[model samples]
Target: MPTITLSEATFAKVKACAEPLVDDADSVIARVFDYYAMHHAMYFNGRLGIAKPNPIRLPIGSRELTHTRLLTATIDGRELHRPDWNSLTREMHELARKRLGSFEAVRKVTSANLRQGRFEENGYRYLPEVDFSIQGCDANNSAESSLRLAKAMSISLHLTFEWRERDDASHPGQAGMMGWDPTSRDAGLMADGSSRSWHDATKQAIERIARDRPRREFTLAELEALELGRVVKETGSKGATPEATLRRVCQELRDEGYLDFLDNDGTYRLR
Candidate 1:
């Protein structure tokens, strides 16, 4: 490995960016550069560092995500970390007890009726506040359960996962790429635009259109006419006229390299 020495001042700054026990030297450097590149509209070539690309922002209950190795969750602005899904479940219960008031209320929302199996088989974990099972689940089921529990308790949970897609098997040794999943459903929780944002809805609509439609290049008028219903269904807030909003989102997507605005005439070609 090549060695690059840092001065004492630089080393201290790097250490400050570290996530205590979770991040090592390589990851610390990778994170700093990734943040810089994202804001400056630059790209960081993979050969320069061990870190993989930065994580994407995903919606919770995304059916497509199978598993994640590490997760950071922000519950109503309070952040917490857990190593795995089971730990996340336990942490959610603890937070719900503190924030959701009565014990019965928590239990009513989280309990799985215990008639079918023994405690060990079910992987049941008992707390004074609630009793819930956390074992014998695949990643998809676990993620779904977490979403269900959060919604039932009216808890606003924003989750970020360090994970790699199945196709990334080509680079088996690479560190996990990150993705954020905001699962909060409460109307009051819409304050941060996580739950209700025109931009988020528009982004989702574009992705859906890209995946479902065969055509790569779409005129602005066609997209506005075709996807207005989808965007409206995804989010309740739409601030501007449909044409203006779609135009702004398409321009943003073009700037982000997901599409190209050819000839400046409002036709978008997927990139």
Candidate 2:
């Protein structure tokens, strides 16, 4: 079994936070692990698994302390294990950039890393994967003060996923266990059965206009008079005519059974 040790300062902060709720180092470690596991499970849809940890001693400054803990857990029978830390860190940085209104400023203060290990218990093996140690430093504070603050505020989230089953079975792992790519956006359909990316808020506006004036057979000129046409014109780049965009939208609506093409005079009625 491999022992994972935290720095002296980190251990002190963790002990202080856990001391109020539990007695002894082992209980404190278990409580912290449980808290993280519960929150992680809540954030992502997955089954919760059990974690067992054994406390060990390590030298911290002049004192011998139980700052190292050996953890073992099995995470089989779940569709997804846990979210990737790199993706979470990138999201945090992006959010910070938006909130702070400066990308360069926020980039200077955030960092994260992933840790992994394996263990065997009672003839069964398990792999332990902790998500990250995400740290945020205050750029305005003095170097020493900032370091202290960062150490106190640092968070290490833990999670586990099954790896032994694939090895034992001598087969490749299931693709579903890998989870969805964080950067990939799922394609969504609009009311007209067109790709949601085809237009901005104009799609919703078009639906609203059609629903409001169900009995009204709209010509190209009449449709262009509505808010949907104005939105398409405003959002479109130069040379992208509002009339052309509106015509395409109507055709899509007609194909999706939401609109009836009235003759060949570029007119449509809501179905």
Candidate 3:
């Protein structure tokens, strides 16, 4: 029922941060802040911008030519401000140095070497170049971890309704709120209106539906057939379409790993 607006620059930054993980808006905002912190730390600390005219000596190791080459390789020919360039190069150098001793040693380290060395290390090894995958039971365990995270956040349906006494001359419109938490099968109601009894009854009905019908799979048509569908329609919230709301909620659930799409179809299965 609420609308959010942002400036073009803010919207662009959010989108850029969300790339390859666009399903979660909260995650996108978090990542945008993280990116800003890493790239703009120096600027915030009184540097004019990301680039500086002078290059400072980095503790990358003994070989000067190899250190320069490594820094250049990490930058990959990007037109970064000098400070940003320096920071990125330093990070890469430290990462490499954790495993390799000197610049020359790090220069000899390649993706192939990383892949080969991954299994050789123990206790949370950091192999930057390795792409690791677990098959069979390990993947099932990973899925369970995702499920745990989703459950920790809990799942709920939030409904807000506005009410006014049509026959009472002195009454002002009041807002009411109701929410159903599927995890606990609990429904809560808060009202600031003369129609408190009606809102309370509505909340009870939502609780009954949530407790009794407990569904693992969801579809727009299925959701529209429920009591929630009627409630949303009766509320007359701006731009609140039953089908769109159902689709958006389903997408959010899927992104949080509480649900998974089945064969890229319109239906979703609880994860």
Best by TM-score: 1
User: Worst 10-residue stretch by lDDT in candidate 3?
Assistant: 58-67
Tell me the tens digit of each residue's lDDT in model 1 across 1-271: 5688999999998988664434567656855654464455434454433344654444333333443443455655677643354555667666665667755555555532222123443344455444433343434455545554665565566555544334533223334322223352322112244454344555555665565667666676666766554453343222345565467557645644678787666777776
Which stretches of candidate 3 lie above 4 Å from their native place?
1-216, 263-265
User: What TM-score, to 2 decimals, does candidate 3 have?
Assistant: 0.25
Q: Model 2, range 36-63, lDDT digits (tens) per residue? A: 8667875655544323233221100101
Say which prediction, candidate 2 or candidate 3, comes out ahead on TM-score: 2
Residue 124 lDDT, candidate 2, scale 0-100 = 18
Residue 73, candidate 2: C-alpha displacement in angstroms: 36
Candidates sorted by lDDT, best first: 1, 2, 3
Question: Lowest lDDT 10-mer window, candidate 2?
Answer: 57-66
lDDT of 3 by residue, 85-128 (tens): 12332333344444445434443432111222334232122334
Residue 101 of model 1, lDDT score: 75
- Candidate 2 lands at a TM-score of 0.25
* Segments of candidate 2 deviating more than 4 angstroms: 1-214
TM-score of every candidate relative to the true structure: 0.40, 0.25, 0.25
